[model samples]
Target: MITFFRSFFNSKIGVALSLIFVALIAVAFAASDVTGGASFGGVGSESVAQIGGEDIGTGEFSTTASNAFDQIRRQNPQLDMAAFDAQGGIDDVLEQMIGSYATATFAESIGLGASKRLVDSEIAGIQAFKGADGRFDETLFRNALAQQGLTEARVREDIRRGLLTDQLIIPATFGAKLSQQLALPYASLILEGREGQIAFVPSAAFAPKGNPTDAQLQKFFADNGARYRIPERRVLRFATFVTDRFRDQVKVSDAEIAALYKKRSAEFAATEKRDVEQLIVPTEAAAKAIAAKINGGASMAAAAKEAGLEPVDLGLQSRQDLAKSASVAVANAVFATAAGKVATPARSPLGWHVVRVDSVSSIAGRSLDQVRNVLENEIAQEKLRQTVSDFTADLEDRIADGASLADIAKDEKLELQVSPELLANGQAPGKPDFAPIGAYQAMLPIAFGLEEDSGPQLVEVQQGKEFAVFEVQEIKRAAPPPLASIRERVATDWALAQGLASARKLADGIAKSSRTPAALEKAVSGASVPLPGIEQIRTSRQTIMQQQGRVPPPVALLFSMAEGTTKVLEGPNRTGWFVVHLTKINRGDASKVPELMVATRQQLGQVTADEYGQQLMAAMKAEVKVQRNAAALQRVKDQLTGRNREN
Candidate 1:
């Protein structure tokens, strides 16, 4: 079983699972904590990491770490960082903190600075910062940043770095070549078709006659004993401490609500709306021609029809909702036009527009009835915060008063859970789920730290909108399942081992005797190889490069062999070795040729981009002549918050 687990760890699914876990456990938590209200550990005050001469600050590192942390936490809630580092937990965060700073500085030195306009545009595009109708709202933007523990300048910088990184990579990887290949398939496969046939002497088809003696079994067992052991796992009990539960405690009085309404009266006030219809003409000359016919007492609809224009109706729309390019001009003209009247001509980014105001409405602020819903939400959030605060305080008081964790949660209406027994190295249960890395990290120490009969310990947990308090109840230890449970599996393994040796012997005989598919097939009658489709086997070196484990080397060797070449490929038992013959040549049909061409071009582009970036960095490093003051960088990182780590 341990051997199975280790082999699994080296498989494709294992690598993918590891990466996915890393992303969830590492990225999300870093993002949250650094951007949240957590204090910076004075990390970025001085330069912790350097690329060339750029001195990144502590504040920047903290912000970057926070963003990265949050991203990681969200993705992998139960990451076993012990497997990565003995220090585990926050040390992973520290590495990301340093790396992010280095990456950011490197980007800046390479002339990949993000512009203010880019940041502003990104902010405007965020739906959370938009008004009810989707127009960017300054108040909403500020409020959202505040919630994330970010200042406007910090958020802007975060957006800037993100954009810069994106810009830097776009041309490097997915430029013209990638785009063309993705858009067309024939452009990818550069080889013409070829003819060939393949036959495999399958290991499964050659069943051995009898079981080996005890000596043979002992030898094999001794040889592969390490493969059968399992990786270590960990057991944990913890208390979570999140502040969202106290949100209800912050109340909004009627007076405060009224005051807030008065202060933001402009926001609440409705703008005059118009039911408008418009026709756009590509040029001022076109607009004039259309306007002329309408001005000469011709119906605007008739003029629009003659000009092959499509009139778009606003249908009770506000000026705030229009695109910036046309909003100002269109709003002015539409407002100025009398109802049932057409505007002469207006110019916008796309072209000139002729507008007709169908109907106008009174100012559109919220009615008394509609304002209640917003007020209720505001009040409820305040109350939720207060409730959470009260709960935390009460739980602390109870613990101080010698009350158990179960008691506190019971009083607070929280849940108590017992996680599946885990091993010291995180090998228990199935694969790790990284959706709650922070919570799991927090839980682990408590579980390990507690003594038997310690009673309940209070821990914080999150469930979407609701917060939770978990009380660890009981724990079970690790012990192997009974032999009876897996006896059939063991017997099957014994049979397969015997079968594999027989299959390999058969294949070796075929490899020495045959040079054609027919001869090979005749040598191993009733073989289970997928040789029928082998005639279509055309592959490239790069395609072979993309493959991993048991198949890659064989494919590469096969590609190297000339037509009519014969050889034997050895593999592990129960997975019989192959006796192969290059019976036909289909350089075009083979997977290696085209895959290699595409891969070569991509590698070339990467080399170019990397060289360009290095050259720029080298120049900048020389010109700046940076004076080292690591302390200053740390102070800066300490002050900063809400930055992306990947930058």
Candidate 2:
């Protein structure tokens, strides 16, 4: 039963399901208990979904959504709330929660449930709830629950439901296997090789008869006007306040540093450590014999060699480290031994061991003078951060009272600057030379998100360092300029298009006449413009892809053709064309390659198992009745998007 539980918990499905409950567990530790009318039973009428008669309440849905949003924000700080909603992040969170509840209901109906004792054991093993002594502490667990606004009853129920769901799903999904007959074909295709000769026809070789006329350039520009249209751009006038500007104004007194040092004195003290070598053997008697030999006349290395054991150097370890790596008994015996002396044999979980303490470093504490500079800098930064926070808050209040950004900048003596017309990516027209403030990269999204009518607002530039208040001074909507304004660009594009058309015609003629490598080389040498000769090279599909240069389209065409055939393929970016001749093909034999067959089998097995699991889950979902509260879902979305209050 223990082995089965271990395997089930370690499976992919187990890890994914466990993460859901673990996230709830983390929330429980971080929030205080939900108060007022928002308690569990009071929120039943706010159910956003009902699965198998199990109501998933709005409070639970909101908590889960908020947690997921915070997690994604931490990973990608630039992602805005609008983008998060557009990506269906909210629906994903809702689906996961509903599915888990539905599966748990199914398990309960089939008489599957975990005992309280089992749940308690699982909770005890969680490292997050452990105390400094490495044992489960009731105080720490209660504190965590209080912080996360969760009750013990709710957390325990989640864990029990998670375990029951795993019990039902693991055996059904992970026991799937595939036959060798089903895996061999894929393995063969993976190892197949082909040899071919390839030649390029450069577009430059087929230049147009002459430069295009003004009328032709204008026609081309009119036909492809959308391709040259300028994107919408915004010009913003802004002022920034940075924390580093006030760092010199803050003071850190010696008395304050002394008090902080005294409060955290233990951090300065180092534990005594010893460098030791241990020799492990299979039996207690053998260990005792070895220890005696080492203590008497035999050198430690010589005795270890005689016992056919290699000594392990455990470098500069403390008592705590030894206790964790080996056993408490071994740790105690080693710490009691004097430096340059050998300890008696001690029995541990590994077997038996003899130890020699090479040297010991005594516990020492750093003097206050040694860390004075670091402490002063830390205190100064803390004060500066507080000052920045207070300043930004006051600035926001002033803005909320309808003060113009320009007036605020003048009154506060802050630098006010206006940006050139810039695109959404913060690039100017014609790639003009301009340098923006360092924080502009972080502020671009906020600036772009604002509407023309929106008032000035404070934007966080750098976390705890800089803030900016900005408003759009002008807007440039996307549109195509007149052809005369960009004639040079239009002419360049027209010439390339004409050149590519000529090159394609020439390539078709060469492919028709050149049946073999010798015929292709002769055609290239006789061409009007000089071209590189064709080379017959032996390579595989994988090899061509891994080479440095751009892969020609012929590489793919050659693999699809039969032996002794020729074809013309268009090159990427209209740079040229390729004439390919297929010479030979080699199909992989499974008997000759064993490693590839094993890998293919595993890959096929995993894919089959995933498909099987999906099918089973779909069937289960169909059997269960689900009713979604559309009104409640809309309300949730509105609340998340800050639109409910507006309505």
Candidate 3:
């Protein structure tokens, strides 16, 4: 029969707040944090989560959850949806949806608005929307949205709600700063120390002797099959070609070169450029004061520093360009000034401006004959790129017309390459030493997502340059290997499992029966088989915190246990159990540690800001009622887990 027990872990952890609150909603997804509550009686049954009056439909909820899961999987390549759901991944997504709408609802009631112009700026500022040239590319933005399975309207709405939440939360929290006096207590807690001893009960020491019978082995394998689950893996077959493939075949004539030269004659014309130092101030008087200081032999940098402003160097630019960037009056004064001299003060919309002429250089105009070679090179490069683009388009047409990757490879006389079966992260499970080819790494995402019987797809390997025609050749679904295929491994695991079960009970009894470290060590030392030595440690929680996420579970548990108490903790992966004893508590004084006090002040200052934000958000949420449709929620979850999946 199956057995279970309750576990009460120390719930005191970090605040997990982030500057990106919208992202935090997706990450924390605390259902309990959603303030108000109502039902779906007025809203339709198709709603998965509801706000005061706004409803998040089943389609949107499922899409949001799946996208979030995809993001988690990117970090943890081996994680599957089942394990993700067990960790409350589904609940978190739903809660984020509810929290977003609730915050929006509350903000709207208070007359806060997220304008269309503001949303446009936010979208334009997103780094993902920018192209290789570092400007917003609409095609790139659309492709990114397509990859995430998100609609433009959905993204805009998400940003809109986020802006609304920020409006409600930021101002209230922006001015909060933790005082040193307020940080003292928490600083002391961070420095507190503990003295403890740890004793291990190795399962290997108590492992069952000899091999199990076939029936016994089968039962154990059946009971713990998930422990041996093989992650999904795929083999991708493809051929790649670079831009160089068609470079030698490209041609550019003298006529084309001459034409380009004529087209860019203005670009090759002579121009004078100047570099200048500029300092802007609120008033014309302030600018004049700085300029007068420079005229009196005081360095522009020094004069500006005294006035609490800095000069910015406008790098070499032509007179016309400077006029456009600054103002016509300022640029004319700058260009007319002698080198290494200050110009008269001028005014622009930003403020008043003082200018210095640092250096100037003039270039003589060039003839068509003088720049013929450069023009020829530029034209040839452009023609070569055009040739490659045309070639790729033709190949795409062939692929669209039912041409296989093999046929393409043969026609192009290219060498086709195949990857070893690999997981989404390009890791080969069976071959632990295997490393994926760099070229194949970029294609794995598309390869893994392809239909089993789909045709070959021509994908860009390196944007605008290298290309690949690939398809998924083989796929192995995540499942347990056959019992006979892993019998020896299962048998070994069974022996360790049997020992772990007994060791857990023994370790528990030892903890309950002994109160002192000496007595605990004595009990552990007298086990049926010889075990490793008991480890004694005396350290501070500060030290454990310093170790960050690397602190061993037993050491962590030792700190949480009450002083003078013995407790049992399990080792990783059921390897063994640990009998822990806390000998003493050493709480140190933090009042004298200036460095720690500073750290505490900084950390608490952030916490103070977050706390203010949280309070504001909580109030907002309380004002807005939230409700969920249980049936629709269940259907979404079912779809996620492959039970009665929707088409």
Candidate 4:
């Protein structure tokens, strides 16, 4: 269960939100006078909100709020962050800020009520604080937390709450207080199981004879008309006008190309490249030691191993190719260092490193031939754009004047096709072909949104071979057939039902006469019954065939069975019954016996904190006598959405 919670929290969206929210919270707290009433960051004393005596100051809130805003910005480049402040996404951020505060406060309160010795022990055991010799390193612990903008006291408080919340949540979700009747079944079914042989009975085996009489066909169709009904569909036709089409048709002269190329010469210039390698160490002391060894004529490989650094063989790269954090220090150092020379005690944001430059290449220029192909391609693209634009303008005028897409396709020498009933997301007939000229997505909105028999919409869409037009030829409404039309289908189904009943009767009679699987087999020998060739069927929901067109229902009901017992289940379509005999029983191990225990305790603590926050919110709401201004919120939301739509 704790695994489930962690998995949920670790999902991409959840992790992103949690990380951003937490950082914002950390900043908010840091900027405030929360720790011992002393403001370390000088966020000055303005509290935004308070939970359980903990102040959420403006500095803390703003830092966190700013980070949260940035996170949102990175995800949606089009979002106007100024609107975040206006629309109460900021308020939501503040609420999360309060929740974090509440969790910390409640944990502290409960932990103090419990014991600090356990919390301290738990903290010491955390692997993050372990040194090379496996002993607890106080300096490392303090430094790591400080890097994350958390103080020792704050981290300890978080740990205490985390542990306490786990203690509170575990029992709430799963407890030993269940009654005997419920517990026995849960234990037996989940912990214990049965083993048996299974013989599958295929549904197709009992199908009626071919060319079922008109009466029978009619009956079947009537009974199952829902399966055959066609979904609602519409016809569509569109023309897309793109800038590229016009751009392609606009011819550029040799003189113009030469002039443009000259103006943008830097864009075509070759970039400087560096070949480099590194031996990375976590500390400046270690990096210095490694540098000394390298300077003493020790091989880079030997020095790296002694320093416990992995030798990263970074091949040739341009400055543009390196990430920002490693670009300047690593890239610059490598390019500047002489070939076969190693830099000493080099530091980058990632860590301390000793750099070695293998070689560097000077910037070069491209020849006319090398750049001619690019220029020619650009010229053709411009021409195609102009052509397509002129064509679209002509087509749109024709369409507005009631010209058919087929006629337009003929006139323009463009391709045209139809699509099957499509959904809002553009799932059409058959498999979708995303590549190739003819394979294209249908305009799903126009196809599904328009009324039936609406004339072909003059729309442009991509299709196989090239972008083309489509003409929805017709519309089909989903409707089931009447019962009278499929009476024969019902009669044949009714006959199969009777056969199932007879098969069940035979199996049950055989079951009662025998006490075990062997005895049951022996008693049914003269009845020409086939043995189910199941080697390891331990659960009941497994289906098995007894004979042609007949099956016992107990196949799936086995999960509900008890050890050393027998059960009967209803067969498919009321066709027959199953007499399931128990053979061997096996129950898998109980989950989270030990390791999950720790994780679960943590998860439980988290839940407890969450619940406490909920209670706090409820109390706060009640105390404030809150009444929402729905009209105002809606008006604000509408205005915000409108602005976003415009963007």
Candidate 5:
């Protein structure tokens, strides 16, 4: 059963079950508000879904969706509802809910259920509900449930369902095996090496004859206008309040610094550290004998060697470090021993230890003069943080009362900066010369999301350093510039496109004419244009796939072709093309590559198990009839999105 559990948990079905457990746990706590009094009006009376004659209520569906949303929000604290909706988060949540309901219905049909005792045991085992003593505390459990808005009954039911589902699925998908015959061919192919002749035909070698005419350049620009179009740009007016600006104004007196130092005197005190060595033996008698020999005119190393054990150095450790790594008793004994003196035998979990203190560093405290600069800087920063907080709060209140950013900036004697035409990526045309009022990267997303009528919003630029209140002054929608405006860019692109086409044509001709490596080499040697240097090298499949440097297109094509076949392969990034001829093919023996074979076998086994589990789920889904009320589901979705709040 333990082996079965291990194998099942390691499988894809195990991963799915783990995800389900997390989802169910999240739903258990978040469903209270959703199920309490919320209604979808006409849709509330309808079933959002039905599986195997069991109807899933609209309220339950809404609750599940709400739980999923809350779980996602907790996982990604920066994620807003708009971003979540754009990523199809709602649809994903609904699908998962539907799947869970279907699976639960199937479990019931198979007469799978969890006992009350089992459910209780599971609840008690959860660490969140446990006290400091590691025992389940009723008060802590109730508080945790209350915080998540979950009732005990609902949580217990979720646990019971999760247990039943696990019982039904885990045993069925456990211990899936892959035969050696199934894995051998794949392992062999991956290990195969090929030797080939590769010749490069760079795009620059086949430069387009003469410049492109105005009509051709214009046509090229028009054809790919969207590629050159700029995204929407915004100009913002903002007022920044930086903590560093107030740092100079803060005065830290000598008295204050002294008080601060005295208050945190312990931090300036150094811990007593010692260098100790030990000879650990299996018995206390051996430890005592070794310690006696070391104390009785014999060297510690010599005594350790005599006992047929090497001395272990516990270098320069403090009391806390010794307590953690060794036993507290050993630490106490070592700390109590004088320098150049051997300590008595100390019993530990490992065995018994004979310890000697080589040298001891006495505890030392720093003088006020030593830490004066650090204290002053800390005090100044603290004062600056407080001043900035107060200033920003006042500015926020004034803005809330309808004061414009410019008016506030003037009144406060703060610098009011206006951004140039800024793209969504925070870059202006030409070289990026503009810096944002605060943290530009953090502010850009929020700035673009703002509406024209939204007025000003306060944004934290740097956590403890700066903040800004900014308003969009103007917006420019994305549009393509005229060909005349970007004639140079268009001409450059046109030339590259024509050059790539010419290179491809030349490569194709070379491939078509030459049937053997010797013939291809002869054609390249006699070609009028300057071509890439030819390098004939033996490369492997793994090297081609995983090498950091660019593997020429012909190198990849070599493995796919029979020996003595010539092929033209396209170059990466339209740099040019490669004409490759496969000269030799080498097959690898799978038995020699044990490491790769083992990895391939494990991969194939996992893949096969995952496929088997997917097939099982599909079959089970087919056996159970499912009905979805699209209208009701959409209504629930609308409610979640805050589109309509019909009761």
Candidate 6:
């Protein structure tokens, strides 16, 4: 899980949109931590880390980790904070933070910098800060930063650091190319084929029939207690309010509608639009000659095709719209001509035009009476926008003034709704079938981020129509369940463990003696218990690489082993072990497939570039002299698991 984190960030959100070092896995600050609080450790623990003279505060480090964990959750929903900690997620997050700081420090040492305008452009480019118009909006930007519980200064500084690192990292790996000679061997190896036979020794085959004693079960439970620990669950309390409540307060007046219609009078008026197919000749004589050919019973399309020209279809355009692209004379000539008729040649800035009208459409004009419903709907929407904006602003002010969800609910006559304990993905730990509904789906991310003591926050769940004011009600820390609850499972695990130990010995003997295919068959037949028959696998290296990392242990081993050699392999999830026998090897010549050779060369070149990036990142870190605060780091881990919540 931790190893994947570095690759994910470096590839998806790296420097200059092209990060390549495993040692540096920074997501930077544009990836907002939707969870409001970053209290991973105590509210204010000792500094989390020190990179050179700069100290990384607990709050900043925790925020970055929180953002990263949220990203990982999108990929693997079953993973919880406890499992994340156990899988070294904390260490990965810290490493990425260190990598980012080190790169920026190294950049600054050599006078590299990020200008404020460049930083502003980066911030503007973030989709989170953009409004409905698809441009940066100060309101949306401020709201986003506020929702993430981020300060303006911090976001700007982090973005600045990201920019500085990008300047240094991109040039270091500018252009890398692998020579044909070096790439040929690797490309040919991709086509190499192998066939192998695999025999399984099931752990269940050598089973321990009886269950464990109570004393033994108790010891096993204690030994693996952490495995049974439940992740932290949180209860969300919220109440939704629709725009209908404020609808009664807003009314669209007839005079206001009239004024709006008057302002956009051209939109309400009738207009003609035509579909035109046109061919422009470089000279007036050429266009006139082509027009005469069409007039003399020759098809316009045939004439154009014969002259090595294709007519352009100007799809559905109004007279004014056509005039914008062509000349006013061209628009007048095209619109005046009937559909299916050729228009007179008209000169434009580009050339002489020969146009044919394909089709024409007209929308009848509507008076105030005809479009009253449409006018009312548009007017109401605009009025409702102002109402909701004021309404939410007041709700925010009330929250700032120390109003709780319950207080606001009673004051505004809103009903409060409470949710069962939920994980980050909005599923209850005990109820696998449970799913988040309605506005709760959107609110869950925001709800989980909020601190328990924080006041209610209004989230625009329906974009403009619906919103929910919510706060965290309860937080249950992850911990082990009672031993009595899982005794049967523990006993089963102990039996499997015992059986697997015996199976390993049997598998080892078979592997050591099976020097030939006949000997492997004899060893398998000589087993004490009935086992499954050996299965043959034949595949190329390219096929295995195509499926990525889904190869079976034995089949993967077939390619790595000597033609006659055999090796024992453990099955995934402790199902059993396998004895892999390599029977044949087929070598490939990649030179015959030029496409494959070129592709392999490009891929190998990227591999070389990646290595260069990794080395440069390592050197920068060594110079920066990164330092970790053991006590501070542990407090964060302990805090995530609720082991040191009080600290």
Clashes within 3 Å, all models in order: 103, 9, 0, 60, 0, 1
Better of 3 and 4 by lDDT: 3
User: What lDDT tens digits, residue by residue, belong to model 6 across residues 294-317?
Assistant: 878888789899889988888898
Q: How well is each residue in 62-167 modelled by candidate 4, as lDDT tens digits?
A: 5555556566655643233345544456556555545445544554555533367866776677676779999878898777766656566655554454455445
lDDT of 1 by residue, 428-493 (tens): 454456343556544554554444456555555553343334444554422233334434444456
- Model 2 C-alpha lDDT per residue in residues 1-647, reported as the tens digit of each score: 11111111233234333354346443342111243226432344487888898777777776767666655555454444444555676666666566566667777887888899988887887777899999999998898777777788877766676677577667776867777777887777766788888888888677576778988987888888767877666788888877788777799999989988888787776678899999988888998898888789788899999878789888898888888988888889899999987877787889887999999998787889988898888898889888887888888888888889888999888898888887767777755776555657766666766667777878887788677888888866555777777877777778777788888877888878888777877777877678777867676655654765565567767778988888888776566888898888888777568887888788888777766655655556566777788778767777765565445
Q: Taking the tens digit of each residue's C-alpha lDDT, what string does model 3 give over 1-647? A: 00000011111111111212235232222121121222322333377867898878766666567666665666566666666665666766666566667878888998999999988887777776788998889998888766654566666767777778777666776677778878888888788888888888878777889999999999998899889987777888988888887878877787888788788887889888888888989998888888899999999889989999888988787888878887898878887888889988887788788988889889899998888888878887888788988998999899889999899999999899888878888888768898876577678767766657889888788876788888889877666889988899899888988899888888887888779877887787777667678888878877888899899888898778888999888898778998889999887688999899988888787678766666665566678867778878877777776545323
TM-scores of all candidate predictions against the true structure: 0.48, 0.53, 0.67, 0.46, 0.59, 0.74
> Relative to the true structure, how large is the alpha-carbon lDDT of every model?
0.53, 0.73, 0.75, 0.53, 0.73, 0.77
On lDDT, the candidate that comes out on top is 6
TM-score, predicted candidate 3 vs. hidden true structure: 0.67
Q: 404-502 in candidate 5: lDDT tens per residue? A: 877877886778777788876677764467664445666677777666667777888879877877888886655576678788877777776778888
In angstroms, give how far residue 556 of model 6 lies from its true place: 2.1
Who wins the TM-score comparison?
6
Q: Which residue runs of candidate 5 sit more than 4 Å off their true CA positions?
A: 1-173, 199-412, 418-487, 494-513, 522-537, 548-553, 564-566, 573-577, 617-647
Residue-level lDDT for 550 in candidate 3: 95
Off by over 4 Å in 6: 1-85, 92-185, 226-232, 244-327, 331-367, 478-489, 589-629, 639-642
What lDDT does candidate 3 reach at residue 553? 88
User: Which pairs clash (backbone N, Cα, C closer than 3 Å) in model 2?
Assistant: 29-144, 30-147, 30-148, 31-147, 31-148, 31-149, 32-147, 32-149, 33-149
